[model samples]
Structures are given as structure tokens and as C-alpha cells.
Target: MPESTPFHDLAAFIALPRVSSLALSPDGTRLVTAVQELSSDRTRFIGALWEVDPSGERPARRLTRSGRGESAPGFLPDGTLLFLSSRPAADPGEGADDKQEAALWSLPAEGGEASQLLVRAGGIDGYATATAAARIALAAGLLPGAADAEQDERLREARRKAKVSAILHESVPVRYWDHDLGPAVPHVFGVPDAGAEPSVMVDCGARRIGGSGHIAVSPDGSLIAYTAALGTLPDEIRDAVVVVDAATGKQLRVLEAPDAEFGAAAFTPDSRHLVCVRERRITWDSPGDVTLWLADATDDQDPGRDLLPAFEQWPGAPVVSPVPGEDGTPVVWFTADEGGHAPVFRLSTGSGDIVRLTTSGAYSDVVASPDGATLYALRSAVDSPPAPVRLDAAASGQEPVTLPSPGQPAALPGSLTEVHTTAEDGTALRAWLVLPQDARPDTPAPLLLWVHGGPQTSWNAWHWRWSPWVAAAAGYAVLLPDPALSTGYGQHMHERGWAHWGGASYQDVLALTDAALRRDDLDGERTAMMGGSYGGYMANWIATHTDRFKAIVTHASLWNMYSFAQVTDFPAYWMRRQGDPLENTERYERESPHLRAANITTPMLVIHGDKDYRVPIGEGLALWNDLARFEVPAKFLYFPDEGHWITKPNNIRLWYATVLGFLAHHVLGEQWQRPDLV
Candidate 1:
């Protein structure tokens, strides 16, 4: 294979098609994936569906095409493909509007033009189809006091004519990540078959916050399980699994625990049992653990059985095997972060045995064959983009067979290697080191320490947002480290930095950087640090603690702990770790990066998005204000239309251009040059 050019050419890099998700047909002979490409104007991404051959004999082909694009592909029992699309309908009288929300569409297995299947007044947010009963369940938003679709339309028109945008909320959480949850409450509706009007199954009243479409129908189509908050208080907002009758939409059972939360319900192949994830709630000192539980689908009063009592690694959503075991018992499969990789693992319901399947790389979108002989998933690693792969369901520590992928990304421009170091407290620390192809000991590349977000997330997979190859293309060695609080490292590793976010985790990062800088191929003297979100928080912390780096870049960073804990989208989640500022000022004062802003001497570039609710734009404003007040050399990069991430293609290009320019000026002693548009 020819070596791909480094991502220095922003246009070329942004134009490359990116694959997001995968879905397999019932028989597993056909696979579909969602690929996103830059829009014609090169400002945003448009998604479309593509089909990959499971036999690997034929090249993947495009399955659906529309200007508005299609996504969330799933297969009905009859081999028809069901997906959501916002494209205008072919019929003028169908009331299709280009700006309307996505509606469900179906393409027959016999190969014909697709047609709109279900159109809701509020538009369908998501839907799930049952294999045995052929029933469909949809999640749609309902206007208050509107009982049916006609009433919903009437209320919407009235509001539009009155020019009213007010949302009366009596709940604790009025807003989610990026949107307001208000006058239109989310409800799950049942559709007996295609083209049938949906009947409300679960009405999440005005105050009840329901899942946005996180629902699963039983194999027999007898029950629909969804997530809903048990209480209205901030601390009591943990989600619980609710099972209801599929036909009547009547509540059958409520699964909840005082110390743990449950979600992601999957029914067994026999439809006799439902398996769900149980996540222990997080506290100020203890990091939570996740395991699986089995509940009887028929009995509402019976408590579920704990499958993995002492599982160390936090498991992802549980997926029941389509095929039963040889002894007539069911099996569950899931992926979990282990060391530096996320691998698939299978659990035997009969013996309670857990076995690791794939050895390396992160796997997702797992789909089991009808006979349960094979599993299909999208696999990715630090050096590889996501690609379809087939795995033997019953095997352990086996390599997966690569299937033909549509628009596979170009080969990486640089080489990847793993680096390891022990933290001060004896915890293992690891990172993926991306080195330039031309790097040599005589001409060492400048080092760029890239901290990952989710301070709790590990750098176990490929990421397009903060890809290290771009820096490597610019002749820099990038250090992608997973320090304390990073997942896949077991509960103890998370506990090391549980409440003290900046203490051990910060030291672990420095320790790993020290280990990497010891390499002769990496130049320690010409080093810089950059991170976003939690990583950005660490960058701010680093700027205050040490003057070792010449420059630092922080994006969507949390600077003031006191203010951030209160203003973030999830105040309760942050307060769980730092405690309330009114009562617990010690943690805020000891760990906050803004309090020590005056001690920083490194030149900093602060980046933020005005629409970001996770970190909030106020963090950037406060950091910029403090930098100016302290007479620090700093620059602020602002994105008005972006959210937590700079997702727009043009905006992202500018981000990289400005970042590279900043590093060149500060770390390499080059003349400062402003980026093109900014």
C-alpha cells in the first residue's frame, strides 16, 4: 500500500469519507454502515448508508442516496432495511418538508425504490422492530394536552401563530446536552405494522423525563423496555429500566435499586429473560462498577439475578446472543476496556463464565448471525480507522476476518508504538506514541502531549476530532496518554483520581511524559501540551504547576471548579465528584486550575465553543479574563456555532491551522503567522 499523505492538507483530510456505525441483516449475509462525507460546500457532514458483503467476495456498495442523507439503519425480520431519513418524500401530497425531522423509511428486500413508512406530527426520533412479532415502536415528542396526532398538529400551529417559544418546565433538568427538554415531552408509541398509525405506549408525562429512544423490544414482541428517571431530584435522576406491554403500552414492571442504576435492556433469544446493565452510582470517593443482571420477563415482582457479581472491568451495553448454548442456556456478549484496548467478551448464563474474545482493538455495533455462528462488528485501533470484521461467536482470543469496507480511510502517514510507565503510586500508565516517518535520533521531532477528554475515558480507539497523525505529519511526536481515572484499567485505577482530579492523574500524565521524553527520537526541549475538556482541564493544571512546556493549548476547558460545578449541563454529576461549593470549598480551592492561574508562565491558546453546555463557554471567558488580568501571553479561539466539539469541517481546519501556527511560533521559535480566515 502506498503511504498516505499526512493530514497537513486540511482540505484533503476533511474530504475523506468517514464511517460511523454498522448494522447486520437478520441472516448476517448483508451488512450496512453509515458513512459521513463533507457536504458540497465543505462546511458540514452528510451521512448515507452503504452495504458491505459479509462474504468478503464483493466490494462494498452504496445502498441509499439522498441530499438529506440516511442513518440509523436496522433490518426487519422479512429482510427489508429500515432507516431514518430527512429527505423529502417523492409525493407532493405526502407533506414532506426538507426542514422537517427524520421519518422512518423502508426499502424492500426484493430491491425497489424506498418509500416513507411512518410520519409523526413531531417526527420520529428513533424506532425499533421486533423479529418475531414484526411490531415497531417509535419515540416521538408530544405537545402537552395533545392526545393524538391531529391535536398535536393543532397545538403546534396555535403556538406558531401565537409566536410563543416559551417552555413551561416544572422538572429539575430543563435542558439536556445541547437542546431544551420542554413543552414537547418524549413518548414511545407502538405501530402494529408498516404504514399503521402509532398508538401511545408510554407517556412520559410533563415532569417525567424519558429516554430519547433508548428502547428495545422483546424477541417475541410482547414487551418494550425503556429507560426513565425514577425521581425528579438532581441526585435522584439515575435511570431505571421500565418494561411495558408492547400492545397496550401498560407498565408491567419497574426495575430499580437504591445503590445501582439499570439500562440497556436486551431480551434473550427465548424471550423468557431480559438482561440489563447495572451501574453502581458514583460517590465522592468510590468509582462505580458496571455488571449485568437477568430479569424474568413474565413476572414483574421478581428481582433480577446478578450475573457478574465481582466483575472488575466496567462492561458496555449487554447484547444477548441470538443462538442458545449447547446446554440450552443463553449467552451474553459485551465489550469492555482492558489495558489499552476494548475487547469483546462473552458470558455464559448457565455457568456464569466470562471469556474474552478479541485480543486487541475496540469493537462496537456488534451484530450476531441468525444461527449465532458469527459476529459482525466495526473494529478500530489507535493506528486504524473503523472497519467491518467478522468473528467466530464461540471462540476466544481469535483474530477477526476483515470484510470489504466502503471508502476505507487512507493508510496512516506515520507509525504507532506503545509506551508504558508506572505512576508514582505503582499504578500502570500507558500511551500510544505517534512518531513522524522521518524522525531520527539526530533530528528529533518536537513532542506534543495530547491529553484525552473524558478524563475517565481511555485512548483505546481511533479518534477523528483530536487525531495525532496531523501533529505527526508536521514532524512532531504525539503522546496520547491514558492516565489515572481512565477506564479499562479496573476500579482501583479510577479510585486513584476519584475525587482528587488533579492530584494523582496529573502526576501520572507527567510521569508518562517523562518516560516518553527519555527517548532519543523525541525532543524534550521543544515540547508543548494540548487537550480538550478534561484534557483541557489538565492542560490548565499543567500550566499552573510547571513551566516545563513552552506552550499549551486548552479547548473547552473547565477552569473554575466552583462555577463549572454549578453551570455545567450535569451539575449533579460534577457535584458528585467535587461536592457542593457552599459546603465543600476545600476540594474546589485545592484542585481548581483558575485559582492558580497567576503562577502560569507558559504561552497559552484558549479555545471554546459558545454552544457548548458540557464545559460551557463561561469557562473560556473566565480563563481569558484571568490570563489578561495576570499579564499572561494568550490567544482565544472562539467558535460561535459549534458545540462541545468543533465539528464543522471549515472550522476544524481553521482550528488545526491556528494550533499548528501557535506551536510553531512558541515551541519552534518561528515567526507568528495568523491562520487564513481568522
Candidate 2:
């Protein structure tokens, strides 16, 4: 009962005041959110640094007191805000532990107190790139959270270098839910004035510091762009889009992002174009569902130029330029769902004309009032929490500004009933199906086709996860399909695997598991399938291509794209995003079901973490050592401390109590200890 609210499909319009990052205060009159309360474990999230309302009779204002884990809010240069944290001292015991990460703070928007400024590792100053122009803040460190923890045998060899691939590991799933635990590096730094006392510039290890966000100045602020993940690794992640010189921090240009790779980014309004969502197939069951590239460069030495002439649907929780209408045109909006409810469209790149403003099945996010001419959009669903409707495109329609959900949910129930279906190629696919308030839509229940993991990351209409509200209070119905590369359905059904990755996304998830076994209360021999990284490689390639899922779990998996293209710590980004594995050797060996591990019989479990360097628990211990050397029926739950998705609430209640005893023993035969969790 963490205040109940779970369905989580992620079209992002989060409630309880979950704004997830917003900016534009440079004299637009006021609008700074980063407000938080994710309710239950991204590590107990607590953020607050809001401030909207400008005398409208009060709406937002909590400026700061988070005790730990916030993220890049950055507003400084006198409007004062800037964020990025993981710091929290003074009381400590919900402490839990995982090493933590996030430090770099600031506060003051007509508020008070908040200042630590930068602590990467404390001093050899080895960080390399950081940005934020005009008021200057640049970093290029070497000693900020720098490794080698004062020799306790080098801190147990830096904790076995947070293992994960020492032959199939599963660590990263530690817990505490916020209030600062300690050390977890995605390794960041974008200093120019991260609130002041900064220096150095550009070297996020050649190109990888821009997740969430990191410095981008430009609109007449003198070229700064800043957002990295710089490549040259196991296959090249190249999280780049750089273009510095914010007063000689140098490294003027380096864009690289071939077909589409960044996953979630923004920096447009004359920053000389830099949109970034190019996320090519990420997993944990879908986020690979975004594609909004623009990346530019006219003088910083040239290289990043996509400009998205076409294809950009679930551009991963997007929000850019939103309030500009009247013949001046800068709109370019994008909230997703174009048709199954979660609206807010705009586009108009000088007459591209996408429009669709706001339709309503709840969940919206347009946002804009720093004086761009009012545009809060916002809807938020799954029981309604984020209200705010205001709009104004220069006046034509809109008015619902209710506001007041600062993390709302004093109690909720009733409203998450949409469920649309269709997919033998009829396409229309977006399911919601949350049932189980004690089950009985005529009682055939006990189904779970639930798949999503970048399959190209697409699932809008705010459902926000709480383990599906305890799997609908342990009764279950779930469904959740947005198939066909999924992302609010547009952009050629999200590149339907552009070069093919198991034909038509594995027969559109085996035709939606035969349309939830003809849904008449759903129990088709107790079906089950799960996902994590690319929906854990489509639940271990649907257990080596179909046994009709009696159970299979898979998280952070790759099984073995030829040893994940050879030991992945990002193996050159899965060999340039699944291509050239030696010119695609027969399509990566008939769709790499871990090279067809003798065909997998099902009854599987395998969730991972051992610090998942990004899907690297040696692909969940190579499908648990080929399902226990071909005995089939497997189960391997590791965590050691966690990483890629399993954000700790007692390890997400031990990953949904081991998928509720593996879907209560393959769909209700019950009797589970491990008969694959069932």
C-alpha cells in the first residue's frame, strides 16, 4: 500500500508531482521543476526544488531538502537552481548501500540553502569534460570519485571491480530508496559553474556523459552544446553531441551517432539543433522505442547533422521549445500516443504541420511558461494525479490548469481501464489491461503476456510501475503490448527492426502470445514471459523460439551475440548496434537465441545485476550455463548489489517475489520454491 499506483508502461507523464526535469527560466517569468517522489525505490526518491505559480495563488515551491539522489536541473547565472546530487549526511541507517553517485548541487530561486558544488572523488582532479556557458562552468577532472579507495586491498580490488562479467554475474540490486547510500557511477561532470568553483572542460572519456542531461548553452550564449558518452569501447557507445569553447575549455566539435543512439536528450532552440533520442533498441523490455535526431554543427568543426527529416515518435519523454506559436513558429512538440489517448503534438518545423494539441485519455506533457506564452499541457493518468492544463498557442483552445499533486495519491483507485488490441499485422497494438482488484472479468484470469524493453522503448499514457500494483494484488491479468518496435505508433512502426532482428519482431511477440490465449479470462495453460534488457533479449529469445511460455524470466540478457560481440562493457556498442558481427553472419546466427542454446525447454528464471555494465551479467550467466547444461528447467536470481533495472525496494521485493513464484508456478499449478518461481 505504498499508496497504491502501479501500471507503469512509461509514456511518461508521472504524477505525485513527478515532472522529471524541466527548464526555460531565462526570463520567461518562472517555471522550474525537477520535483520528485517516485514513491517507491529508484531508491526512495525525494527531490523538490519546484517553483511554478508566480502569484497565481501558490502551486509549486519546495526548493530543496532531498537528503539524496536528484539530477541535472541546472538554471544558474542568477535565476539560480542547478542540480545533480547523491549527497546526504547527518542521519544514516535507511542507508542500505550500493556506493551511490550524483553530487554537484545548488539552490535559490528566491528560496535558500543548498551548495556543495562538485566532489567527483575529491582531488587528483581527473574528471575531463564539463559545460554550461555564459556564467561559465567547465570540468575535466582526474580526482572526483576517482578509483582506488585507500587500499583495503584497494577496497577489495575496488569491490572486484563491481564484477558482472566474470563469467556470468548478477550484482547491481542494492537498496535504501534514497537518503544517500553511496558510489554508483555513470560517471558524470559538466562543470562551467555547476553553481560555481569549477574549471576544466571536455573529456567524458572521449564521449559519454549525457544521460538525463549535461550542459548545452548556445542560443546566443556562445556555442556550448554539452552532452556526452563518448565512444571507443567494447563497441562504441559514443554518447556524444559535444561542441564546447564556452570560454576556451576547447574541444570544439565531436558529434558521432550514426543511425540513432542517445535514447533521451534535448538542446534545440538555436543551440544549432541537437535533439537526440536516436536510441536503437535498448531493453528491460523497451525504451529502444525512441527516435528524434537533429544533432548539428556549422562551425565547431562539423560532424553531427541528422535533423530528423522523418521518423521520431516516442522520442523518449521529449519536451522542447513548446511555447512559441504566433507566426514566429518554434513549436516542435511531442508527447506521444497520437491516438490511444496521451496527446500533445505540435511539430511544425517551419510547416511540417503535425498539430493535434491535446486529446485526453489522460497523460500529457507539453510544458512552457517561462514567458513563451503559457503551455503547461500535463495530464498524467492511471488514476489521475498531474492535472495542470493551461495551453495558448496564441489562443485557440485550452484551459484546465488544476495543478496540486505534488506527488499526489492520498488514495487512488478506478481509472486504468483502456486496453486496445490488434497485431497479426493489423498494427493498432497498445494494451493497458490492469485488472485483478480481486479478479473476475468473468474469471478466466491468470495471464501475463507483458513484454516491453526498447523493443524500441514505447509505452505512453502514464502507467508508472509499482510492480503492477503488486501484480494487481497478486491475482494478475496484465497484458501490456505496444508491439511493432513500439513508440506511440508512428515513424514506420519504429523501424520495424530496420535490418531485421527476428523477423517482424518475432512475429509481433508470437502474435501477442496468441492474443492472450483468446482472452476469455485468460489462463492458456498458464502462460508466462518476461523482459529486461531488450525485454531480456525477448525473454531469452522466447525460450529459444517457442514452447509457448509456461514460464521464462530473463533480465539484462543478450545470451551471447557471439559472446555479446566479445565480452560486453559495451562491446563497441553491440558491434555498432547489431551489425557487422562479421557482416551479419546469417543474421547473427539465426537471431542469437544465445546461438540457439539447444532450444530451451522453458521453466526458466535468470534475473541479473552483478553491476550490469549494461546488460552484462555475462548475459545472465549465458542463460544459466545453457539451462543447467541442458537439463532445461532453470533458475538463477543473482544481484550482489545491482545495476540495470532492479532499483532496490528490497531488490524490488526480490524482483516481484521471484515473479510471484514464477507466475505462481506456471499459471497457477502453484507449489513453487523455485520450480521456476511458480
Candidate 3:
């Protein structure tokens, strides 16, 4: 029997299995994905590997399962499945112990128990497999001064024995989004085959890999390419794609530009070219841009060619087709944010031609069939969670077929529709509105304007962190707008709010919210606003600028701009856009929400995580203090062990409960019922 609560219940919703990534076999006969579900203890989510039929004829089957679980599934050329897991080895002599980290494991194609293939001191961060050869490129971290894996292991053991947990940093960025970066530096390793000993391919040394841990192996297994951080200064530190000889560990070429950062390298089938994403460094005068770059693997002096030179939307990392196009030219498949959807696009390298392959949904973890006739990816939209889907690689404006997935949720409590409007400056503004099933003109639902985080991001994809459906389940209409600085729209949309956080972006948000309120199913009088990170920043901005919202919830938000610029985890990145607080105080003085805190009359709920280095806990603490000083009706929801995102399952439940209760008390005129656990 189905659960009584259904997906509308927070408990049942959190327990639903989630499928994340996909890995296709070299021969296109098998497809594998990683599914994360609630553990038996119900404290955390555990990931396990699952096999989905490539033909979509059979039900998805579980391939590997353990308390520690497995993730990052990939297949060797011989059809052997490999993954990373902290699970213990079946044999006692295989060296699986309590101190074991995530190591590489392989399951044979003939079928049997999986065996440990490789182990490292710091564990394997991620790995890449060659499509045409039996070669694997793995990324692992090594302690300072450790010559080899054995020494690294010994050094780790020594630290464990001494009970020391300190990291000495000499670079500008000592910490990342949530974790501190130091003690060990990531390096690339090459394994000729499953049995072969791994050899160093690219030693990252002191320069930490800043971008995604992108590592790709050439089809012939002779070369490896990865993103390597360059420069020592804080502002100068940018990522560059580095190609090296797989066997000798010799640096073949470094693809770098003075004004641009390059990473996410994908080698073509012929191994003569590489496709990567080039990010233009942000400056005070202009916003950053990204495009698909095709770099020559053999020529060191050749600057890469831009495939999407005129393309407005930012393209994701390129996925080189296993087989060339019909014209015999290499074709690259990639997804880009386009008009509220992340669609897969086919790019012909030789002809510089691009075509959209998917008509809807945000796609990720895309992989191509060996024959290049079909593509597979995990697709998700505002009303759905990520699920495996199959698409035609060459077709234009085609809808993908959904494959059987474990992550599919039950029927949503409401429906999703679009809200369109024009900003004050005549710019187009759009939002997604979720209306409850019972909402009607006579009994309209309360409105909740949920702003998205990444000021650089869009509200196009499904986000587990902020599911509008949760609010819809409570008979509330949620509006998710793609304001200025949001992707998927043209570059002009981002530039419209560049450095002027309170100008166009704020107006665009209000414009869409106004359009949403005009609907008959929404109640404008009983409305609230909430956001996290940049969205949190917006909530604060909205509260100070207008008394429209009955209640405002801000999480991990920036209150004092001057303080946040100096204390954020990556100071240089934000400083590039806001400029130095000491010299450039125009945007800071005009836009800092804390400056206008006294204008905030709306009841507010401040939520923040102690480990949130992005916005820092100080922002929330300061905002709470300001609300108290102003004698504004307010509450503070603090998470001591959480980061920018609430990852702990129980804490997530409490988060939703607290926010809902707060909204109910303020917007729905319900009695304040504090969550029991809180």
C-alpha cells in the first residue's frame, strides 16, 4: 500500500529516492545511475548504484548497496562498472578498515561480487574513463611533501595518531564554500588498466583546483586534460585547462588567457581537439560571460576557437560525441540555460553549427550512446525532481522519453504555470507560479514570493533545497521569478542588474510579483517573501524597500555589504563585482540593505547556518540584532552544524516546519505553533 501522507507530507517527500548522475556503457548496452535514499537510521541519505536499461524496456535494478553506499558510476572500455565507495572490502585482507576513505571499486561484467580496485590516503575525489581504451584518470589529494601514495598514507596516519586537525594555508583563499582547503592538494593519476598501478599525471601542487573537478582522458588513452588553478595572488587566481602526457606526467600545454578562465575540458574521439568552457573574469565595469571553446590538443600556441561566440546564454561543459556527425566532423553535445529551460544542444565542431536537441526541462549528467544516435541525461523541472531520460542526439526541438527512475515523486499538490510582465524599464520579466489544487477566485491561496539564490542563476530547474511545491501543499501560491542577473535569458538580462543589485533586479522581481498577484487564485493581502544567499539578500532588500510582504524569511543572507565583502569564503570573486569597499562605495552605500533596516516594518524570520562561509553567519546575526534594535516582530532560526545549505535530513525537516509555521502565523493568521523539535 502507498504511504498515507503522500508526497504532500514533508516526511514522505523527504524519504523519496533521488537519482543524480548517469553513466553509459562504451557499447551503449547499459546505463547506470546513482540513487540516494533515506538510510535505515533515517538520519542521512545514502547513495547506491542502480542500473537502468538503455532500451527502457526493463525496470531499473539495484547494482550495489551498502551502509556507506557508492556513487560516481562509470564504465571501463571492457564494460566493467567502476564506482567510488567507502564500503568495506569483502575480503578481510583487502585493506578495508574503519579509517578507510572513499576508494575505487569495480564490478566485473561477467557478474560477481565487486572488489576494491584502488585506494588512496585522501580518497579518490572523482575519476574519468576513456571511451576507446582501458585507461582511467583519477583525482586524489596528497599531503604536503608526500612523494608517493605510501608516504601520503603514512603522513595521514601520523596526523591521526597525533590527533592534529589543522590546515596551513599560504594562498588567498583558505576556505571554500563550506569546507577548508588545505593539508592535501589534489593531483591527477592515470591507470593503464584496472590491474595497473596508478601513476601521477598532473601534480596540482600548491595551486588548488578551484572549479569543478573536471578530468577527461583521451580516447586513445595517451593524454589527460584537467582544470588546474593558476597564479598565486587572490585576484589573479584563475582556472586553466592543462593537458599532459598520461604516461610520463609531462605537461604538454596550458590553455590560459589574461582575461578569461578555462576549464571543463572534454577530448574529442580523435584526441586531436578539446572542448572547454571559457569564463571571462568579472570586472567592476562589466559582468562575466561564458562560451563553448574548442582548443587544439596538438598545438600549444593555438588559442581555442569560440563555438558560441554570439550565443547569449551560457553553455555548460561540453560532452564530445562518441561518434562524429553525418558529415564526418566532430560533434559536441552540451546543455545551456535558454528561456527558463536547460536544453541539450548539438554542436558541429567543423561547421560551427549548433541545434537545440531537447524542447523542455533542465538536463544534467548527459552522456551519449557509442553510436551517437541517442543521448541520456537526468532531467528535472520546477514541478518534478530529477529523473533519467533519453533524447535523440541529432534531433531538433525533440521531447525526451522518461526512463524508469527511482527518484520520481508522487502527484504534486498543485500545478505550475508561468507569470509574465514587463519591468519599469520595458524589460521582460517572467516568473513561475504554483497554484494549490483547491485555490479558486472565492478562496484564493496566500502568495509566497520565493527568490532564487545565485544572482547569476535562473529559476529553470528543480531545486531540492527550495521546493515551491511544499508551500503549495499548504494552500499557498509560490512565485519563482527569473529577475535580472538570472541566466537562461540573454546576457543583457544579467548586465541589466550588474553591480546595481537594488536597481533592475529588484524592480524586475516586484514586477513579476505584481503580475502574479493579479491572478484570481492568489491572495495579495496575505503574502510573504523568502530567499537564501542572493535570494536572502533580496528578501532583506525587499523588506527595507517595501512593506508589501506580511512576513519575510531570509537565510544565509548578506545584511552588511561592507562586512560581507571582506569575510566571505571567496572574497576576490565578489570583490570583482562590488569592487573594493574602501575605494568604491557607490553600490555599497546605495544598495546595502542594512543601511535601510529601520525602514523594515514587515515581520521577519532570520535563518542562517553557522558553517555558511559564503554569506557568513555574521550577516544573519547582525540582521537579527538590527531587527531587535528596531523592535520589529522577528525570529531567528539558527543551525549550528549546517552550512549555506541545510543538508542534514532532520534539520531540513525542522527548517521547513519552522518556515511554514512562521508564514502561517503571519500570513494565514494562524496561531504561532513552534515546531516541537525546535
Best by lDDT: 3
Please give the TM-score that candidate 3 achieves against the real structure: 0.97
For candidate 2, give the lDDT of residue 173. Answer: 20
Task: Tell me the TM-score of each prediction against the true structure.
Answer: 0.97, 0.29, 0.97
Off by over 4 Å in 2: 1-214, 218-225, 229-433, 436-442, 451-476, 479-533, 536-538, 541-560, 563-570, 573-592, 595-678
Q: Best candidate per TM-score, number? A: 3
For model 2, where is the 10-residue window of minimal lDDT? 172-181
Task: Judge candidate 2 at residue 255 and give its lDDT.
Answer: 59
| Model 1 spans with C-alpha error above 4 angstroms | 1-6, 199-213
Q: Can you tell me which runs of candidate 3 are displaced by over 4 Å?
A: 1-5, 92-96, 198-207
What's the lDDT for all of these models? 0.84, 0.55, 0.87
- What is candidate 2's local distance difference test score? 0.55
Clashes of 3: 0
lDDT of 2 by residue, 1-678 (tens): 323334331112232346554544555556655666554444455666565663346766666665564654656546666666666533323531233545455566676677655544322112221123434333333322344223222433455577622222122122221111123323223344443343353223322333534554554445555556554332444455566655554566665544445534455555555555555544322334444555454354444433345645553445566344455645556666544445665565555566655546454445565545656655665445454445654342344555543655434322245455566657765566666654544666676666667665554445444334456556666666666666566766756654566667667766666765665666676667777777778788878878876887787777777776655554444455566666667557777887788888888888888876656677788689888998997778888677667664445555777777777877677787642222
Question: Candidate 3: lDDT over CA atoms?
Answer: 0.87
Per-candidate Cα RMSD to the true structure, in Å, reads 1.9, 23.7, 1.9
Q: Model 1: per-residue lDDT, tens digit, 559-623?
A: 99999988887788778778888898888999999999889999999999998988889999999
